[model samples]
Target: MWNGDGTVEVYGFRVFYSEVDCVRRIFEKYPETATNIRPKNQMVKNAYMNNLLDLIDIICLAPQELTEEELRNAESQLLELVEVGFKLDWLKNKLEELCVKKKKMEARGARMRELDGLIMEQRRVLWELETELKNEENEAVSDSARLGFEDVV
Candidate 1:
């Protein structure tokens, strides 16, 4: 349970043991970390806290105002992650499934387009064949008329 008062010394965010140790060390080293609790997870909840801390430490050590701003944002985001408390594994799995489904739909669409093109070509050939047959019938009729006139003469 978090005390509704904004002391922020202890994070209500759930973190793993690895994070606890790294955070414990950071808390001991930095007064800000001790008072402001943001749970930074590295890989898993506890395992990756140190990696995030390391990035923060680098940014803090750098000589730029923007770096300070980035550090603040990172800290805030870490706290927000804890507050949201969505499972990372579940999100990863959902993303993978979505990617697979999208790829399959794309392939199906491509195949349908290919089939449509083939159908159009077949239709064109059939129309050309019908036109040729009509021309041949007209030629045969004219030949027969000429022969009948010659017979009359």
Candidate 2:
């Protein structure tokens, strides 16, 4: 959770500083967030939950509709941390680009299939026309042989 205006709440799992550093001898469950994570005075913030509700809701609600087998077979750990809003927007925009690309590819494939069918039909017609042409030429040769003369122009 973040404070209003996208500031860190100062008292949550995402706090900047904590009072609980220890000698390395003891085991610490949740290590303090690294100093390199932000400047000394700067606060880290999460994206506006409302703005990201579409992705968040998908995360929250997807498991309910899945059968146990589906869950087991599902892809692993696709969910990720959104470090900043810009990255999230880039991801969303990238998804839109992929959707558009997929549609264009599908249309191209459909057109190719239609063209292939047309080509097959045209090839059949071409074969039939060639056969008929040979038959007509043969009949003309036989008639000439029977007449046994050439007409001069």
Winning model by lDDT: 1
Clashing pairs for model 1 are: 42-48, 42-49, 43-48
Tens-digit lDDT track of model 2 for 1-153: 444553344322232222112212111422332212332333223222222333433334333344444332221211232433113433344444444555566688799999999999999999999999999999998877744246432
Regions of candidate 1 where Cα sits further than 4 Å from its true position = 1-86, 143-152
User: Over all chains combined, what TM-score does candidate 2 have?
Assistant: 0.42
- Which pairs clash in the backbone of model 2? none
Per-residue error at 97 for model 1, in Å? 1.7
What are the C-alpha RMSDs, in order, of all predicted structures? 15.0, 14.3
lDDT of 1 by residue, 1-153 (tens): 223542222233334444555555654554343233343442244333434455445444423333335545555545554444422333234334444555566688799999999999999999999999999999988877755666888
Provide TM-scores for the models. 0.40, 0.42
Q: Model 2 scores what on Cα lDDT?
A: 0.42
Runs of candidate 2 with Cα error greater than 4 angstroms are 1-87, 146-153
